[model samples]
Target: MTKFPVLHEEQVREFYYNVEFVEDDSLHTWVGNKSLYLDEELLEKILELPDMHCAGVQKKIMKGEYQLLFEFVNKVLLPRTEKHIMASSTDLFVMESLCKFEPLNLLALVLEHMYKTVIEHKGKHRMG
Candidate 1:
């Protein structure tokens, strides 16, 4: 059994907000002409999971490892969102109330928002 890292909402927020973009000369010819890198410490911590072993998680991020992270975020956030929707009287109230409790739920919202932003950005930069 693999033990995944337990992430707090603050950590997730920090990770997304702190993303560093750099110029990759190799990718200069690519559509966006830019590259993004995550904090190495975050990657190391996540890779510590028993089932995960990689020479470099950052490299894998560009190769689609990020979808794995998104999946984890969804796994954490979806249940809570569902619970709130089922119990709350108003949809607006549920969203507003999401931030009142554990940070994990808030982190889920942030992750979902970021994921959508990335998809939109990628689509705008597509080679087509």
Candidate 2:
């Protein structure tokens, strides 16, 4: 799993795309010299998970809405103990991902974020 997400900064206005860069004002998340973009395809994979897998907190998953699903994805797939507080969530792209059934490739996105965290904070005490 990717260690740190490509978050959008509601605080920083200087950067284009409102993208949060990690450490030293440098873009820590990158692929081929360009910054890494966030992916919502994780949502697609989550949608397909068996109802049994999703029955953890809720008795059953409600398909029409994805907020619960997104939180579940974060908890299980992306893996965070924090439940319900989306962190850096977006809805439109997730809806777009949910609307489509085509196969999604999450490998590269996963790699970049993982690599970014490793390269940026390889030592010392803090982690993202």
Candidate 3:
């Protein structure tokens, strides 16, 4: 069996295409651009995850969207617990550990800020 659980190819494609890197402010934003150098066939077969940002959590922290942050934590940080355990309680606790404790410690605090921003602006149509 593969060490990492399989994720949908479409989901992985979306993640990569949606990821954006803002050049001016040094803040990498997910602009949902599909203009990358990845091969279509390869992208169709593999799942790519988001990288964490090292910048401060001011973006997520000031917005009071700790729950949203937690969700990201679950998605990015709880892979180990998710892979081995089937219990909801343990999974939930592992999810909580993103904030207080960590076993893998692979979670990136930087990209999380961008995640919070994207989620907050999800439904609105910004014309700029």
What tens-digit string does per-residue lDDT give for candidate 2 at 6-105? 7655322222323455443234334334654433343335554221110133313435456565655556655533344433322223333455753333
- Evaluated at residue 66, the lDDT of candidate 1 is 38
Candidates in order, TM-scores: namely 0.21, 0.32, 0.19
Candidate 3 structure quality by residue, lDDT tens digits, 1-128: 66997778765546543655443323322335534433323333453432222112322333345556555644665433223212233334444455566442123332333444444443341311
Q: CA shift at 68, candidate 3, in angstroms?
A: 1.4
lDDT of 1 by residue, 46-96 (tens): 444221110122322332433443334334533332212121122222233
Error of 2 at 91 (Å): 8.8
Model 1's alpha-carbon lDDT is 0.33
Candidate with top TM-score is: 2
Instruction: Compute the lDDT of residue 38 as modeled in candidate 3.
Output: 31
Error of 2 at 17 (Å): 30
The residue pairs in collision within model 3 are 52-111, 53-110, 53-111
Model 3 residue 89 distance off true place after TM-score fit, in angstroms? 1.9
Model 2 lDDT at residue 108? 33
Q: Which is the winner by lDDT between candidate 1 and candidate 2?
A: 2
